[model samples]
Target: MQKKIVKMFDEIAPSYDIVNRIVSFGSDKLWRKIAIKKSLKHLPKNPKILDVACGSGDMIEEWKKYTDNIIGLDPSQKMLEVARKRFPEIKFYQGLAQNLPFDDKSFDVISISFGIRNVVEIQKAIEEFARVLKKEGILLILEFTKPEKKSTIRNCIDFYSNKILPKIGGIISGNKEAYEYLPNSIQKFYTLNELCEKLNKKFEVIEAKNFKLSPASMIIAKKI
Candidate 1:
């Protein structure tokens, strides 16, 4: 499953960014910017950042605004290649989230945006995030979430997520399965409350918000 996911990402590497803009209507950038702000709030002047599943190193670029000690890690070598090309000075590594190749307490801030659900062993990945993060380290997650049942607003978002999004994304990226799998993954993944429960085992959930009628979410936690 992991290999298949890596291959899927590798195939979509070239079109990932553009397809994301199309699917999210550019709101993805705002989501990420908000995540960065929440993660960096009250942090020290200089904080080390690690962006796991950092496709093409978008987080690396954003983190660089505050500090230069930033690294990107992902399982797809092709994605990492794009990241390397974009920011030659920023270091990037090809690795799985479940088994990060980093020392304990290596980063003061760790973030994974819109990619956590793709992880096969999601629990292990969270554990690894806790292991490598410094005590009181920030853990920020920006991800798609399944919408709540029955509200008109949520119904519209659900229609967009399960229907309109995949259609547009598939056409743009030319890897329809990749886009189709995205909405399904979010539906099958944990709810915000359930996710916070798992996170609370190793970290304290400090801030949480729902975006786009609960179809997306942001979570900022600190290592316990």
Candidate 2:
């Protein structure tokens, strides 16, 4: 399943960012900015940052505003190819979050946006994030969340995610199954508290803030 999903992303690499910006109505960029600011709190004067599962380097580009010593890692080579072409100066590697190809305590900050839930072994990925991070390093994760209000707006979001996102994403990306997997994965992902608990096993949870009325949240955890 993981391999299939990676290949699907490889096929959609060309239009993935375009579809993402359109589907999220440009709020994805704001989410990345907030996540970066939260992660920057623990960073050193000149921090070394790693972005895992970094689709086409959108988040990495956002991180560049704070620091230049950054590496972007993704499992899909095609996605990396696009990212490499777009940001020729930034380092990018073909890698996975579950098994990061880095030495222990190698980075000061690690960030991943909307990608952790796609990993096959979520625990292993979390462990990998902890392993590569330096002592007191910050690990930031921006992910989709289930709404707490359960109001009409929540119902509307559910309807759009389950019904409309896939249709529009498919038409734009020309990959129906890939777009379908997006909503399915988001629906099957863990909630904010659950994710915080999982991170607490390895790091200290500094903050967890929900955005867009709880449809998205960013969790910042510091390695102890």
Candidate 3:
């Protein structure tokens, strides 16, 4: 299953960014920006950053705004290829979140955007995040979560994600299976409180907020 997910991402890596912008209606950028800003409040100047599951290095780009000491890691070789080409000065690693190739207390901040849900062993990945981060290091997660409550806007988002996003994402990326998996993964993912509870085991939750009219949310935590 992990191999298949990596293969799917490799096939769609070239078009992933374009499809994301279209499918998210450009809100994905805002989500990352907001999360990064929140994380920065707890970080020191020029803090080292590790962007796990970075995906063409979009989140890395955001981190670059605050610091140049940044590394990107992803399981998909093709995705890392794109990221390396885009930011040749920065290092990119092809690795899984469950087992990061880094020393303990190696980074001041670690972030995973829209990629944690794809991990086959979520707890193991979270443990790895804690392991690599220094004491009081920031961990930023911007992801899609199942809605905690039913509402009119939630209904609209559900309809768009189920009925519209995959079709458009598939058309643009030319990999419909990958796009179809997006909504399904979100439905199976933890809610905001649930994910924070898991993070609380190794870190103190600083802030968590769901975007208005969107299922996307962010959690910022500090290593305990």
- Name the top lDDT candidate: 3
Model 2: residues with Cα > 4 Å off, grouped in runs: none
Task: Give me candidate 1's TM-score against the actual structure.
Answer: 0.96
Number of the predicted model whose TM-score against the real structure is largest: 3
lDDT of each: 0.86, 0.86, 0.91
Q: In candidate 3, how many clashes are counted?
A: 0
Which 10-residue window of candidate 2 scores lowest in summed lDDT? 145-154
Q: Per lDDT, what order, best first?
A: 3, 2, 1
Q: State how far residue 42 of model 3 sits from its true place (Å).
A: 0.3
Q: Each model's TM-score, in the order given?
A: 0.96, 0.96, 0.98
Task: Report how far off residue 110 is in candidate 3 (Å).
Answer: 0.1
* Candidate 2 lDDT: 0.86
After superposing candidate 3 on the true structure, give the runs of residues whose Cα lies further than 4 Å from its correct spot.
Answer: none
* Backbone collisions counted per model: 0, 0, 0
What's the CA RMSD of model 3 in angstroms?
0.8
